[model samples]
Target: MFFVYKILIINILYYWHNDCFTCIGNINLYHMRTIKLLFTTLTLAVLATACYTEVIIEDEYIDEPVLNVHALLKSHELWYVDINATSGNREVPFLQRAFTVSFVGETVFANNNIVGIGKTGNGFGLDVGYFNTANGRLQINHDVDGYWSLEVFMVDNNTIELYDSNSRTSYYLEGYQRNNFDYDMVFYDNIEYLLQEYDVWEKVTTSKEGLLNDFDSENYLQFYIEGNRSMFNSSVDPSGMHLDDVLWDYSGEYSVFGVYNDETLKTLTLDYDFMGNDYFELYVINDSTIELYHSSSGTVYKFKGKGFISYLKSGISQLDKKRTKTEYGTMKVVRKRKI
Candidate 1:
């Protein structure tokens, strides 16, 4: 029984260590958000908790204690790790404990006895571990946003050295999306047709949810240019929202590296600031619109950015193309200029 008590303490400490980190992390990094991925998972874990009821079995039957760690670091918030005992005869005996993310950095959160009481799936409770009074589900506030990477240890004996950016919260981001922008530029002088502006983000895929930029039709996208650099608004969350609505005038700036693909003349290499974060790669559509695809989330954003260039840009003779006014008092593209 004494040996069993030792194993129990080990299991509790492994998980509670994380909780202590969380408690300390919350105090130290109050400016950062407390993002929780486990809240959604608690539903199933809570159901499993009903089967458990503090048992102290013979330590002789149990094997060496093996610990498994799972940490999810997102949105520039607190680091969290789920600690569990793996190589034991009793399945639930290993139990589930969580510690703050700092464990990867320091050994301070090594202490255990952090317990969550009352409901099994509920937040921290008074019965165990370091968080004897923490309650409710782990929460991540909406306004709090940003991202960072960490060396996370997982149960499968592998380490994820990197993570996705904050922009990819909606999609299942893959590793390829984390590449840096460093390469030779491919400029096409004649492809200035892309500089014209319009609200080109029309419905593309049928998923409806696929469209990330959903600004009002009347308040379409626009671009302001000076030299090779241009400026525009960084897309806000909830899609369809405009910076004006939030009284924010945060405009993003990007350098025009010109067309990236010589053969297609459709791809543009732009280095742009998205609320301080920079990203690259844009595609031109029939000399009318631009497209940006975030590989991580697999989301494609379209921007009319500017109106179509004048006759000088189209390389038309002006005589071949005729513009006429319709009865409704709007100009129509009746015909294009030819050589």
Candidate 2:
């Protein structure tokens, strides 16, 4: 049936072309113009048949394995630096603040400008940031728990100072000192003693959960204690005398409690009134005790240790409050670490 149709169409074209050509010689102006139009149409049809396009469609959504790229500070280290067009010239690579990225394992992220050292699995990872760049010389010391923690500072082009957290000691290195390879590897006997003492503290606090439950109903004096010693505490006085006093209040996505005094990085406790309004107390304390050795009072107020759940809940509330304060407006733009 298809062949027969093709044959019929061909016969019609042949007759039409023949009629048009014969009429062109003896016809009037109108008839000659019609023949020309027919001839042009047939020529176009023949040309169209010879030129056809073959199209191939591909499925772009097919799943396949792919390797991802990350900003690598060192071979084993990766840090997150958010790139926005407005950062700078849009050409130079900016040393970004450090953050950890967990690709296969944990990676330390530090403010690339600061010398950083942290405890690695069995050894330590250290990087020095200088040279108009960051993490210029990435080095590691080998020893089981060899260099558990690090702090770095640049003394000069060839010299950098480092402090180890595990050892709690500092060392200086000349630019060309020991081929930059050999570490003076000092073993502090005192570190061993401190570790043993710390172990005793750990054993006593191992049953923290049971201790918290035991004080389920006890009235605290505005402190949270890990043992007889308070790890965190707050104030109860409304006159804003305590560190945990109503310095600020917030709620929403986060709740916040903050205390500021003349001292920088001073320690203080935040107390919460679990019975009254959801307000918290802020009080100053010594190392691990809610007791404040005030020059005026010269007496220690036995602060109470609230339960872990309430303390954490109050902390969360404080986070929300902080967020609100940030939204309102920031008085100072102090840089801090975040994860």
lDDT of 2 at 48: 76
TM per model?
0.25, 0.26
TM-score, cand. 1 vs. native: 0.25
Candidate 2 lDDT at 254 equals: 13
lDDT of each: 0.30, 0.28
Steric overlap count per candidate = 23, 31
lDDT of 2: 0.28
Model 1 regions lying over 4 Å from their true place: 1-188, 197-220, 234-249, 258-262, 265-274, 278-280, 304-339
The candidate maximizing TM-score is 2
Candidate 1 backbone clash number: 23
- 1-339 per-residue lDDT for model 1 (tens digits): 444544765676568767777675555443233323333254345556655679878667757543222223222122222222122222111011212211222111211111111112221111221111012111221111212221222223222222123222111111111122111111122222234223223323222333343222222334444444455443333334543343323455534433322333233233334434433245555434455544333455565433233321234311222211111111222211111
Cα lDDT tens digits for candidate 2, 83-178: 221122212111211111112223332221111112322223232222211233323321111223334555445434444444444444332211
* Candidate 2 TM-score, C-alpha based: 0.26
